[model samples]
Target: MAEIQAKDSGGKGGKPKAKKHSTKIDMTPMVDLGFLLLTFFVMTTTLAKPQTMEINMPVKAKDQEEQSQLKASNALTILMGENNKVFWYAGLPDAPAAPGVQVTDYSANGIRKVLLARRSNKDLMVLIKPMEKGTYKNMVDILDEMNITGIGKYAIIDVDPRDEELVKKVQ
Candidate 1:
């Protein structure tokens, strides 16, 4: 709705004055149209699907002896430490003649490269162990790396005492 109000001013000193008008615009329709468009868009638009990574964890064995043992040759153990430091070693940490522990980071050239290099081996298994001082983000980054490298067999595990010793020696 709109309206115009006119004011007529009589002549001053025998001269006629022009009429002045003020216009008022109603915004009800504009508001209604805005709401209608909002509702239409809200009803018509589709929400985006959440981005997520799928993980499959192994079932636990009831008996201690029933648990399957991972082969030393097929294993790559990654230890997450404070300050974004990452330590890795092949095979069991306590194995006789265990491979020397090496330090790396979460960068594309660091752990990602190591995982990519070992991705050719179908039997490759990765054990991710987060230390006491490691951040939750560190775990997430390692998991992301696993996904990026397409490493199929991996586990988030507790750090063993021997593994801690190895990491301590490295630090």
Candidate 2:
């Protein structure tokens, strides 16, 4: 909305000239429209949902020696190394008849395939041991793979010297 007003100059015994006018505009409508748009956007937009990782916490035991252990046949140890290298084996690394560590990548056909093949074994347990020099991303990728393969029984264990020796042998 605009309002116009005229300015009058004193006429002193001479012919009057054209009067000058000035325009004043009201910006209330524009301000109202701006607020309306802000409110609309605030009401219609959605906030992102937070992502989460599901973990099962172990229960406490009074005596450390009373813990139950998984059998070697059902245990699978996965070692996470640099360059996305994965070394896995069933049973302890130093045990007799235990298969030597084998190298594989983090692809669907690699670790995922191995996990899937052993998923049917009810007591199958996976122990992830990330190398000291390994990237945190390698650990995360294997954990994601563990979830994807639906392996419920799994643990993140410290790297054993024997396993580290095998890791060095692989590279």
Candidate 3:
């Protein structure tokens, strides 16, 4: 609703006064229309879908002996520690000729280099061991690296006691 009113200035010295008009605008329709547009946009707009990484786990073997046989040369172990520390070894840490555990970060030149070096091995399997002090971010970072490097076979296993000792020694 809108209205206009005229106000008369009082006559002074026997002179006629002029009238001034003032307009008032009602914004109720505008306010209601604004709310309707907001509601329409909110109801019709689509929200982003959550992004998730897909991991394919191996099927269990009936025989324990068959399941226990993992090639040492084809295995790579990555250990996540506190403060975003990363340590990796070419093969099993406790193998007969145990490989030395080397420390690396989560940068393109660090773990990525190591992963790329062995990417040619078709049977390469990466084993991720998150230590007690490691954060969830560390785990996610390594998993992302696995995806980035196109590593098909990988597992998130618990850190062994000997692996923990090795990590401590390197730290």
Best by TM-score: 2
- Deviation from native of the Cα of residue 38 in model 2, angstroms: 1.0
Q: Candidate 1, clashing residue pairs?
A: none
Candidates' lDDT values, in order? 0.90, 0.87, 0.90
Q: Which stretches of candidate 2 lie over 4 Å from their true place?
A: 8-21
What TM-score does prediction 1 earn? 0.83
- Which has the better TM-score: candidate 1, or candidate 3? 1
Give model 2's clash tally.
0
User: Least accurate stretch of 10 residues (summed lDDT) in model 3?
Assistant: 61-70
The local lDDT score (0 to 100) that residue 148 gets in candidate 2 is 91
Clashing pairs for model 3 are none
Q: For candidate 3, write residues 1-171 as lDDT tens digits.
A: 899988878866887767889999999999999999999999999999999998777788787677656789999999999988899999987799967999999999999999999999999989899999999898889999999998888888989999988887887
Candidate 2, 1-171: lDDT as tens digits:
889999997788778988999999999999999999999999999989898788988887887998886678888999988778899887877677746788998999999999999999998989889888789889889989988988888999899999988777767
Q: Which window of ten consecutive residues has the lowest lDDT sum in model 1?
A: 9-18
Off by over 4 Å in 3: 6-22, 56-68
